[model samples]
Target: MDLNISNIIIASLGLVGAMIGGFLSYKASKSATQDSIKAQSEIYNKTRELENRRIFENKRTSAKIIYIDFLNAIDEGLNIVKEQKRQHVGRAPNLLPMNTAYSSIIVSLSEELNPEELSVINRLYGIMEKVRHDILNLDYILGTYDHIEFDYRILLVEVFGNNYKEMIETNLEYITRDLIVEKIDREYKKVFEKLRVLGELNTYGN
Candidate 1:
């Protein structure tokens, strides 16, 4: 009877030990599964962020290209205006052509810009609009006189002179002309410096 009791107790204890071991194994598996899920979630979030940054950078670069093109058109128009003014004693009616070209360029640039870059582009657009308004006022002044008289010439010179000054001062850092190209290059370097940070983040996981 004593031996049978001892055998039963030993059997019961072994069964209990097996149950506890099985429970611990299950708990460990659950914990590992949760950790794996959390790690995967983190990776997915990082990948999504990197993709967004890449898209933003590409859009910004595209907008910059269009802006640079528009600037080139503006410079060309300015050169034409200056040359025409120098050659003709009176207000030549050629301002309309130049103004139209500048307007078209601005329209093109505005269409290409993404919303993220719109603020800076809009500011530049506003400046162009002001320049256009000034040109229109100059046109009215010139139209009042039948021929390019001394007074009319002086008004033309003053208005256009101021316009040129404003253009030069505002765009000195962006103009690609050889004389100012070095300054523009420096400005471009700064732009790239900002871009590089974005680029590194984008390429990090890859």
Candidate 2:
């Protein structure tokens, strides 16, 4: 029970020490919490970037596959036309028009497409659509006229001469051996090269 100045000083020092320790503990805990939040934010950002890249890759692969398929179909159709022209008699060959995959794929990835790519795809799509429409119109025209078992296209060619195949050539030149085919082939090559440069190359060989 010695209430001297030394005892009072010791008690005061102990209180100050406890307060400083408590403040330091609070500061450490706050700093740790902030660091954890920052780390979580960084992880979230990285995850988003990875997901975006994956989506872009998938779209690119899909576009390449679709484009190549359409190109193959065009080649096949031209070959069919050539074969039919050489060997066909009586009935006209049924030439199925190309699908709308070109437009569909382009629309799906519209957000990431550059202006040149977009323009190229749109032009190609337009050509495809116009060709499709022309084929349908030709079918209608042939349907209206009655003829023998001969191929309606051959009949039309005989009836119309050079003017008859104008639309067909414009639409079919991409896949045919006609003189116009070279120009269309060059256009396709330009577009495909651009796609390759954009990192949208397909797994399938050219």
Candidate 3:
């Protein structure tokens, strides 16, 4: 029997080379898979961040619109007194719009709202309820026959000489300007502070 050390060494070398190749291939495949997973995770994070920003922006826009509408309604509410003095004016004399606007602003960014903001909102709701009660009392006095329309409002001032309707208007203006509007300003500033801060931070990046 002839023993060939060269051939044996060559065969051993070939087996080691194949083993090394397989190990390297496995490592390369694992690295590629890890890279793919990392890329997907980054993409998911970016997408989630963008979605969050979109939601925040939407909330901000909704808050702005509701606030503007409430301001307009407040203007209308406060103007009811002046409107009573006028002989003829467009739109009726009612706090319904303001009430509706206030209701609409119940909670847009509730998470961003502090206790003070919530308190002010409750106070404003209370004031609105008082205003509603006054209106109902007036409606009862009027017998709800024709409803509290514009003509009735004007007629009350003409006949009563700014007694009933004008008195209510004056009262509404006082409470709204003093309590409701004041608290609204204070609480709105505080409530929206976090939103503003987050918005500024988002401007940079995640």
> What are the RMSDs of all candidates, in order?
11.2, 7.9, 9.5
Query: CA lDDT, every prediction?
Result: 0.46, 0.54, 0.51
Expressed as tens digits, the lDDT of each residue in 79-134 for candidate 2 is 44444343543233344344566666676667666767677667655644554554
lDDT of 2: 0.54
Give candidate 1 misplaced runs (Cα > 4 Å): 84-206
Candidate 3 off by > 4 Å: 1-3, 84-91, 94-108, 122-206
Best by lDDT: 2
Please give, for residues 112-139, the per-residue lDDT of candidate 3 as tens digits: 6666765655554454455455565664
Residue pairs with backbone overlap in model 1: none
**Residue 33's lDDT in candidate 1:** 96
Candidate 3 RMSD to the real structure? 9.5
Q: Give the TM-score of candidate 2.
A: 0.55
* TM-score per candidate, chains pooled: 0.41, 0.55, 0.54
Ranking by TM-score: 2, 3, 1
Query: Alpha carbon lDDT of residue 47, candidate 3?
Result: 100
